[model samples]
Target: MSKAEKTKQHIIEKTATLFNTKGYISTSLSDITQATGLTKGSIYGNFENKDEVAIEVYKYNAGLLGKTLSRSFSDEYPKALDKLHAFVDFYRKNWKFVFSNGGCPIMNAATEADDSFPALKNQVKKSFELWMSKISTAILEGQKKGEIDKRVNAEQYASLFIMLIEGGILLSKTMGDQSFLNHALDKITHMIDHELNILPS
Candidate 1:
């Protein structure tokens, strides 16, 4: 990468966690400067403004989340049902990585950006749309492969799963009770086993 691109990436990487944990409005330029050890002019030279920089940071944060989910869907699970289970197991096992980073980036960003920060809000919206689409696509694929029930509604289950996961994370983070998340995951597991999965007669 060119020097400018490298510098811009440096700024994004340094401030991603700070913005995720602190929220955009609360995270000031000084925080980025302190975290990145770069001067205001240096940041400005790389980014058009704070909002622009924040947009890029949100992309970086969202990218991190995408990588995690992609890894969760890795080749270990040959069937879609197993892939879904692996996805849950990924989060369940990575609670520390999730909670330590102040919760899911999409959830945190959307909650913080609601009715505010239009550009950032739109970013959050796209992230969710992509997530929902992924889940729905997986459901449809499973149905085609005879792994999931053909009668199940792909879009419906997709939205439901997102709601469950995001709600679970929010409750767990706010209540200081990790079991809330596990409880939600348990419900998801039930839905998958009894509702989505096809059991042999």
Candidate 2:
């Protein structure tokens, strides 16, 4: 990468962590500068303003999530059921990072940007849709392979899984208890298995 691109990526990485920890509203320009060790002029030179940095940080955070999910699906788990398990396992292992200081960036941005920033809110919504679509596709694939019950509705079940996960994460964060996540995962796993006509082991 070029120097400018490298610097821009550095700024985005630093800001993403800050935003995830301190929140978009709470993370100030000073925080970004301090974290990045860049002056106000340098920060502005790279980004137009705090909002611009925040938007880029949100995208960076989303990209990180996508990469993690992608890495979980390897050739060893080519089957849809195995792929689904891998996806859930990824979240289970990374619960700490996923539910860090400020919680899910998508949820945070969705709530904060709704009335304040429509454009950012739209991006958050699109990210959610993408997640749901992926899960739905997996369900459909499993159904085709006879691993998942053909009677079950892929889109509906996918929505349920996503909603349950997001809700569970929020609840876990609010209660400051990781066990909530375990319970939530248990419920979701059972739901998926039951829908697939398989008893949960």
- Measured by lDDT, the strongest candidate is 1
State in Å the error of residue 181, model 2.
Answer: 1.3
lDDT of 1 by residue, 71-123 (tens): 64667666878777877887799987888887898988887888889899999
Off by over 4 Å in 2: 198-201
The lDDT for every candidate, in the order shown, is: 0.87, 0.80
Once superposed on the true structure, which residue ranges of model 1 sit more than 4 Å away at CA? 74-76
Q: Tens-digit lDDT track for model 2 on 130-189?
A: 888787888788778777878888788778877777788888898998887787788777
